[model samples]
Target: MRTIKPVQMRSPVLTVRRVDTYHAITVVAPGVAERFRAGQFVAVAVGGDTSSMLARRAFFIHDVKPDYGGTVEFVFEVRGRGTSWLSECRSRDLLDVTGPLGRPFPLPRDPVNCVLVGDGHGASPLFPLAHTLRRRGCRVDFVLGAAGAQRVFGALAARRVGETATFATRDGSLGLRGRVTDALPQVIEDARADVVYGVGPLPVLRTVTAIAAKYGVPAQVAVEERMACGIGLCMTCVLPVVGDDGVTRMLRSCVDGPVFRGEQVRFDDVGTIPFDALGAPGWKARPDDSASTEIGQ
Candidate 1:
């Protein structure tokens, strides 16, 4: 039971490096670094003090190190103005960061064979997760995929941490000539994976969930949704999820989870509220519309 504390800090950038397809930044935020767990993320205010970018950019914690007391690192692609601003960050520049947010990936109570699946920059969180899993005596395997060679985040790191690591690329520039899902079944079978953990785009998660289900292996997924307020107040990152009580409701990814039991999520209806979901309009409507009849009638 890890308690989450919401900390806001102005931390100095320790270092910034241009990875093949993304920028990696290390910031001296001891509070965040000490408390961070896999799947938790940080919301960074970009564009400096005078810039107009009000929305904080969210990134999964790539790694944490005990330097300058403690430091946290995150990786991201320069997808837009916010990230572009982040890219220009240099050593000693201060960044306003809010973090150690969101529920972390749950490690099993007993050691089990686990397969981690990540795609593109989404692979950021898997490294630390692998370390934790390995320390707990779990046999870890990795299946990482990207559009091309440079886009793959941690092939070398994966090999270092994982018992077995497999890579895939859409352009055949890597280990396999397909998506991660294409190589998943073989990996799962070879590893005799007892469970799976995945973090990536929704489509990739959906596929991983489906494959895990097919093999009767449990799957946990961390969704990558655009979050405005990582603290969950905004309700901007809601997605339909089915609870154990068998009711489907919109859950906020920021708080309720960015990580969830794969089978419990309505992946196909993520963007649209399902007609039968709890609290949905007309969800309890009578088949004959008798409930709408006037009392006088």
Candidate 2:
């Protein structure tokens, strides 16, 4: 079992950079930096102390460094009011951050050929994971895609870390003109990948999972779901998943996963509860009607 040390701190922003389609912020957060693993996320309290936004914004940790005791970095696009406020933040500004949360990507014990797939800003987490794999003597191949070149995150970095890096863009601004899945088959075949790891939008992840299955390679996917609380209490990010015991249940993405084996998830039934799930209507045992009727008589 893994122990997580979560801390709520007013971390000082060390640096901020405006990447093509998003903003990357580095903060002086020792606890998060020291404890963070690839695929875990941080929940940041946006709009400062008196602001009206009650929920925290979640972001995947892009990187962590040893600088300033420790520093954690995350990248985000301004999709809404919360992220807009985060984008306007300047260096030395104090922001409330809670983090090192969620299950990290499980790594293989022995070195193997691995292919990593990411789409848009979802590519952030793959760099650190690739670094770890390379350290273990694993050959890492990267397949990254976006609508255009600017939308592609970590292209140069992926090239630097991976043994072979392939890109796909919808508008033909970079590499191939298609989705990541379009480029995946050739990359996997050429690399002779033994396993696959992916993080991205639901559609992209589903496609990646399908491709990996067709190739007979195992896949692990980190899903990007809309999280309101970033914790398990809200029950807002639940999705239907099958367990090892052959039962299906609604699992919270924030706690139960964000990372799950590709085969275990029923991608077609993600948004709605399956009729056969444990707690679904008519699935649970009902009280005996005869006993109740006799008491009433």
Candidate 3:
């Protein structure tokens, strides 16, 4: 019979420092913040109860700070029952948390015109990415997309890390008055992006992948998959992948990666393939939003 191993864990009532509606959720989890990485995630049990949750909800690490005991950060749109619960908690309430899970985004080998594209909560991880890129002397250009201006990244904050940045909104309520993908041509053309990294809706990633392919720019994506165990034991969230040898394979997005190259992922084959065939429970479509789209595999 399948079983769950006991994991020694800590719970804390994280005060909600700030809420960037479309951008992120800044939490004051002092000791846990600095430990996470860009693209990595944490599984949280609201109100410290996992009984009804079945599986802890996974959220993107987004960003963390070493100070304030290193508060961990997550940016997500309110789309499900778990998060709606999260929204109800008071500023200083603790949560049952486990993680620093999932593979992190890749750091550039050398400074290239790295383009960071993310929309809404997907934009969370770009902070560290942009920071790391700037530290390495790589020119960074960030393009953020969201429903409206209220749903955007920390603008002045991002400008502090990246050299140049742009914004686009679906309702034309913000920067470009269009989708992030719509501003790609302009962002790419203006910044001369040579390496591209993205996190957002699958459709957004798909569009980014195509643009990168057309431009011959090396790009990577942080894929969001439903995860139950948060460990490799559950074959619930396997994503089709190609190995270094060019052979097709299956990889667990929760463990092996949340980060994958634009080329390695079988994007076209995702929703089409049967789940049982891919070492997962069943084909559960995790549509667009990377936030609420949980892969309870």
Candidate 4:
């Protein structure tokens, strides 16, 4: 397979259809939009510069209108330079982007009550998963967690798509002011879930996964990591992957995943994206600007 190169492509200015501060972006990029999946991501060349990596940032595809030639929308948060750039971008400006990379959410093999937990930019990937599950007649409760009112997004949009929505803000601005896990007691009490969908900070994912496991519920997490060669060669996006044998392997998050089972990941190594092999510099980690909603995908 040819590694997707930044050099040989014409960046498109994805006209903003709409924008949600700290929540989502609706853009019209029909060419790359149609091919994306819920857990899969697209690498965006910030400011359309191919030379210096502001790195090709990855976004979890939130809404994919296939009829619009795959024109899609993205919902995420503003964390650093790249994302900030994404926020400041004008409607008609062109930017380079690539692929529906990595594996998608595991469509549950057995039907069970599904609870979707969204935190920070982690919320982006679950939109499609929630919608698809609801269509299949599964009962889904979507809980969004944020530091304050500013971090939550698309509640009305989520409801329209068929998920029963709730919010847990740390500041108590609108909903519960505790951690996502803190809301679990009441949430799970109302409904016994078979599966839990989570996207958010490492600590949150760890806590969510632990809670689900304690209750015998299967949990899946949408993982995001820093990327460079979106196809995996750069190894800039290495995250722990669990194989059938139960051993955690460091897989290139770019190609292998931006999605992993909650139980399978090693959250202790969350942000330690190896700049060198075991922190050495001879094989230094490239200066990476490319990032995702979470950095362990």
lDDT for position 170 in model 3: 85
Task: Tell me which of candidates 2 and 3 scores higher on TM-score.
Answer: 2
lDDT of 3 at 39: 72
Q: Candidate 3 on 127-219: residue-level lDDT in tens? A: 877887888889988888888887887666667677777889888877898889888877777888888999887788888988888887877
**lDDT of prediction 1:** 0.90
Give the Cα lDDT of each candidate: 0.90, 0.88, 0.71, 0.67
Model 2 residue 238 CA deviation in Å = 1.0
Per-residue lDDT of model 2, residues 1-297, tens digit only:
466867888999999999898999999999899888888999899998999999998899999999999999999999999999999999999999998878788899999999999999998998889998999999999999999999999999999999999999999999999998999999999999999999998888889999999999988898899888888889888877777655677888777777888777888998888987767886753353221111000
Model 2 Cα RMSD, Å?
Answer: 6.3
Q: Give TM-scores for every candidate, taking all chains together and pairing residue i with residue i.
A: 0.94, 0.94, 0.82, 0.80
Show the lowest summed lDDT stretch of 10 residues, model 1: 288-297
Give the runs in model 2 whose Cα sits over 4 Å from its true position. 284-297
Which TM-score value belongs to model 4?
0.80
Pairs in clash, predicted candidate 1: none
**lDDT rank, highest first?**
1, 2, 3, 4
Selected candidate, larger TM-score, 2 vs 4: 2
Kindly report which residue stretches of model 1 are placed more than 4 angstroms away from their true locations once superposed.
285-297
